[model samples]
Structures are given as structure tokens and as C-alpha cells.
Target: MIFSVNSKVLEKVLSKVYPAVPTRTPMPILENFLFQIEEGKLTITATDMEITLRSAIFIDSTDNAEMVVPAKLLYDIVRSLGDTLIQFQIDIDNNKMQLSTDNGTYNIGYAASSDFPSIPNVNHDKKFSLSAKQLKKALDQTAFAVSKEAIRPAMMGLLFEFNIDGLRFVATDGHRLVRYSLLSEKSEIPEQYVVPERATSVLSKLL
Candidate 1:
């Protein structure tokens, strides 16, 4: 299928998802972004198995198709194009995709979408909807006290506990245990969840 999309909009959405793509991965396809075209919308997704980033942009297209293209290569091609409309065509038989811009044309190889693992469908019925600022305050207060030691898995992360009175975050590394709490009128936490320090850092920045 062939389609045309605004290069600037594509780049902006890709930038948000690129942070989740890892430099090294067991499956080469994990380092790539999955592109799905349906009707007049283009869906781009990137993942490292644990975290998935997805965004949809409207484009001009005739048919629907999907492919897995290297994220880095796609980013480089889009960056090279200078504020011009880009025409993208995919040839499934040859496993090749072509990108055309005002300056020039480029072709790259891509893996079939079937080879890539399916993205997980997580069901979050009881989610806390907090503003970025409020979440930032909660994370900032406890992140500093999170354990740096990886020897013990449980001690290497921050603990999130919600109760009838409030929500609490705890972290320790054998030396010091720091706890931060915030009262909430609308919380019904059954149990506590432990989130890794690295994951906490990423979540903090993204929020």
C-alpha cells in the first residue's frame, strides 16, 4: 500500500515513543516500530516488551496494511526530510519499503509484521487519575530514597501501598527506609505493589 503523511507530525509522535526503544534487544524486531495503516489513520507503536508506546496520526491512504521497520532507520529518514510531504510505499513481496521526499528517494528492508510479538493488552480498571504535577510531587518526595542495590530484588525498588486513609510510598536499602504518604478520599487499595527503581525513574519523567 502507498500513502502520504506530514513528516513533521510523524516525527513529533515518534519522538515520544522512541524513548521506550532499547539499544540492545534479544529480538531484533523489538528495536523496530510497528506501523499499521487502516483507512485514513496511521498507527505507530514501539515497545521493549515491558513498556509499549503507541500513537495514531491521520494520513491519506487508499488501503490498509502493516509492517515492522527499524525505528532508528525510520527516524533518520524522517529527520533528513526537510519539512516536505513524504510518500511511503510498502512492497510485501520484496520485503522492502520506499520513502520519497522532495530532496530524494530511499529504500529500506523491513520485517513482516507477523514475526513481531503481539503487544500486551493490560486491563487497568482501578487507575488513579492524577495530574502530572501531583504525580511529580509524589515521585519526587520518595525517589531519592529508593535503593540502589540490585542484589536483593525486593529492596531494590519503591513500594506503593494504598489504604483507606491515604496512599503511601516506601523505599529502603538496609540503611534507611523512607516513606511518603498522601491522603485521598477516593482510594480503595487492597494490597501493596513494588515498582522497580528504574521503572519509577522512567515513569517520573514521562508523567
Candidate 2:
């Protein structure tokens, strides 16, 4: 398969998802980015099993394909290329992928799409929107209070409580605790979810 995209644009998309790639992992596959191209859109995804990040951009491609490529190597290469058009050629037979720009061509080994873990589909039946400012403020107020101890996994995340009064963000280590409330449309049914600390950290940066 062959496709072309602007290096800077691809770099931006990769940056958005790179945080989810763990620095140290027992599973080597988690160190790579899952690249999926369908129709004319290219999607890049990375996950450390605990959290997943994905970003997409339109590109010039005549075929559909999926492969896993080394995340750090690819991102670093694209970032150094400056503004240029990059042509990608995937040699499935040899399990190799080549990236070519006006200045140079680079080759990196790739793995079959099946080797990458599948990303779970999230159910969006009930959803709400929060401005970046509001979300960032809430995270700033509560993230510090989350527990660092591994004994209790539940306290390592922030509690999201939705009720009649409003939505409350709560976090607690064994001693200190914080609760921040934001007034919004009241929900008839109260709900609670514990968002992992790693996920919250990455989300704050993105916002």
C-alpha cells in the first residue's frame, strides 16, 4: 500500500496520541502506533493498555490498510523533517515500511495489524460536554489529591459524581481530600465513575 501526507500535519497528529505510548512496557507491541488507513483518512492510535489516544487526518491513499509501526522512531523522524510531503510505501511481503521525503528516505520494520491489541469501543449513550477551561480547572483542583499508593487501586483515580446538585469531581489520598462541584443541567439518576490517574494526566495536557 502507498499513501502520502504532509510531514508537519502527521507530526501534529502523532503528538496528540504519543502520550499514551508507555516509556517502559513488558509487551513490545504496545510500544508501536496502530496506523489505520481507510477510504482517504489515516488514523493513528497508541495505548499502554490503561489509556488510549487516537487522532486522524485525511491523506491521499487509494487503498485501505492497517499496520503497527515503531511510534518513537516514526514521530522523531517526521518531526525533524520540517514542512514536507512524505510518501509512505508498505512492503507487506518483507514486513517493512518506507517513508520518503524530498530530502531522504527511511525504512522501519512493521508488524501485522493483528499483532496489535484491539481498542475497546466506548458507549456514548449518555454524554456531556465541558469547556476546556472548566475541565482543566477541575483536574487541577483534584488531581493532586489522588492516591499514589498501589495498595488501593480505587483511590488512585478521581471520582466523577453526577447528581441533582451538579457534577462533582472528588479525589482523596488516605489523608487529604478535595471535592469540586460545577453546576450544570441536573441529571435524574446519579452516577459515578473513577477515571485512572494516567488518563487524567494525559487529558489535562491535551485540553
Candidate 3:
């Protein structure tokens, strides 16, 4: 498969996904990004088991392919390059991916897409949207109080509670606690979810 995309554009997408790649893992496969190219779009995904981040961009490609490439290595290389066109050449038979630019050509080994874990499909039947500013503010207000202690697993993340009163963001670490609510809208169904601290931290930067 072959495809070409702008270096800066690819860098931006990588930045959003790379945070999900685990810094240290017994499963080395978790340290790579799942690259899926189909039709005219390129999708990049990374996950640390608990959190998954995926981003996509349109690209000019001659064929479709999927492979897992080292997240840190690929992101570092792309960010270091000056704004230029990057042509990607995938050699599936040899398990190698070649990236060529105006000044340099680089090659990186890749694993089969089958080796990468499948990303869970999120159900969107019950969904709501929040402006970036509002979401970021909530995260900033509560994230500091989230527990870092592993013994109390439930308190190690942020709580998202949805009810008729609106949505509430809660975090506590025994001594410190924070609750931020947005009562602009109401929901008939009351639901709650615990978002891991890693996910919240990464999401804050993206917002």
C-alpha cells in the first residue's frame, strides 16, 4: 500500500493518539499505534488497555492496509521533520514500512494488524456533547483531586454522573474532593461512569 500526507498534519493526529500508548507494559504490542488505511482515510489508534484514543485524517492513497507501528518512534520522527510531504510505502510481505520525505528516507518494522487488540465499539444511543472549553474546565477543576493510590481503585479516577439535574463531575482522594456541575441540560436517565486518570489527563490536552 502507498499513501502520502503532510508531515505537520500527521504530527497533529499522532499527538492526540500517542498519549494512550502505555509508557511501560509487559505487552509490547500496547506500545504501538494501530494504523488502518482504507479508501482515502488514515486512522491511527493507541490504547493502554484502560484507555483508547483514535484519530483519523484523509490522505491520498493507492491501496488499503492495516499495520501496527511503534508509537513513540513514529511520532518522534514525524514531529522532527520540517513541514513536508511524507510518502508511505508498506511492504506487507516483509513486514516493513518505509517513510520517504524530500530530504530523507526512513524504514520502520511493523506488526500484523491481527496482533493488535480490537478497539471496543462505543454505543452512541445515549450521548451528549459539550463544548471544548466547558469540558476542559470540568476536567481541570476535578482532576487534581483524583486519587493516585492503587488500593482504592474507585477513587483513582473521575466520576461522571448524569441525571435530571444535569451532569456532574466528581473526584476525591480521601482528603481532597471536587465536584463540578453543569446544569444547562437535563437527562431522564441517571448514569455514572468512572473515567481513569490517564484518560482524563490525555483528554485535557486534546480539549
Candidate 4:
């Protein structure tokens, strides 16, 4: 695999999804990010089996390939570099990568591409798109009140409620509670979803 991309833009995207990557996982492969290159676009993904985030960036490449590179090391290297083009050269046979730029060169050890976890395919038949501004507002307002009790799965997450009137985002920690409501154009389908606390946190940063 070979590609050239902007370090600053790549770092921004990785930082957004890195929080969802668990520091300690039962499977060593889970500690890496799956990088898939196709045509001139590069797709990067990070997940902890629950919340998965994928971001894409345009790059210059003639070959397409996929591999799992150490997440923390990749993030650190990009963040430490200046705003210059980063040249990535991958040795698939040995599962190693070399990054070079004006600043310096770095090498990272990676795992077999087949060992990475497959991203779940979500059937969007029941999916609905909500405004990012409104969703971020609601998440910021109510995230603090999510209960820490693991036994109460329902309370461990933020309750997203909607009705004919409007929508409400509510959360509580048994002692304190918070609710953020607002008017919306999408109307009249009464439904609710319990968004896990960890997912909510990532959503807040991503939005």
C-alpha cells in the first residue's frame, strides 16, 4: 500500500474516533484502526465492539489495500508532525509501515488485515436523520445525568423521547436529572431509543 495525505486533517479525524477505542481489549487486534484505501479515498475506522466511527479523507494513491495499524502510535505520530504531506509505504508481506515527511521518518508495526473486526452493517429501514446541531445540543445538556448503575441498563443511557408535540432528551443519575427539549420539523412518530453513555460521549465530540 502507498499513499500521500495531509497530516493535520488525518490527525483531526483520528482524534475524533480514538476515544471509542478501548485502552485494554481482550483481542489485541481491537487496539488498532482499520485503514482501507480505494481509488483516491482512504477510510479509517476505530471501534470497541459497541461504538464504531469511520471517517474518510481524499489522498493520492495508485494501489488500494486494507490493514490494521496500531491506533495510539498512529495518532501520536500524526499529531506530532507538522502540516506537511505524509508519505506512507506499507510492506504487506511483513505487516509493517513506514511514514516519512519533512520533519522525520517513523515506522509502525501492524497486524494482518484479516484479523481486524468487520464493521457492522446497519439496516437503515428504521433509521432517521436528525439535525447535528440539535442532537449536539441535547447530548451536551443531558449527558452528565446518565446513571452509573450497571444493573439499570435503561438508566445507564440517555432516553431519547419524541412525540407529536416535540422531542425530549433526558438523563438522570438517581440524584440529579437533566432534560433538554426543543421544537423540531420532523414530527409525529412517537418513539424512543436508549443511547449508551459511552456512545453519547463520542457523539458529543464528533458533532
The TM-score that candidate 1 achieves is: 0.87
Two-way TM-score contest, 1 vs 3, winner: 3
How do the residues 1-207 of candidate 2 rate in per-residue lDDT, one tens digit apiece?
Answer: 888889889999999999999999999999999999999999999999999999999988868889999999999999999999999998989989999988999999999989999999998988876689998999998999999999989899999888888889999998998999997746666899999998899999999
What is the descending lDDT order? 3, 2, 4, 1
Between candidates 3 and 4, which one is better according to lDDT? 3
lDDT tens readout by residue for model 3, 132-203: 999999999999999999999999999999899999999999998899999996678899999999889989
Candidate 3 residue 109 Cα shift, in angstroms, is: 1.3
Could you report the Cα RMSD, in angstroms, for every candidate shown? 2.2, 1.2, 1.1, 1.8
What is candidate 2's CA lDDT for residue 42? 92
For candidate 4, give the lDDT of residue 140: 91
Weakest lDDT window of 10 consecutive positions for candidate 4? 182-191
TM per candidate: 0.87, 0.96, 0.96, 0.91
Q: Which residue pairs come into collision in candidate 3?
A: none
Candidate 2's displacement at residue 6, Å, is: 1.0
Candidate ordering by TM-score (highest first): 3, 2, 4, 1
lDDT measured at residue 10 in model 3 versus the true structure, 0 to 100: 95
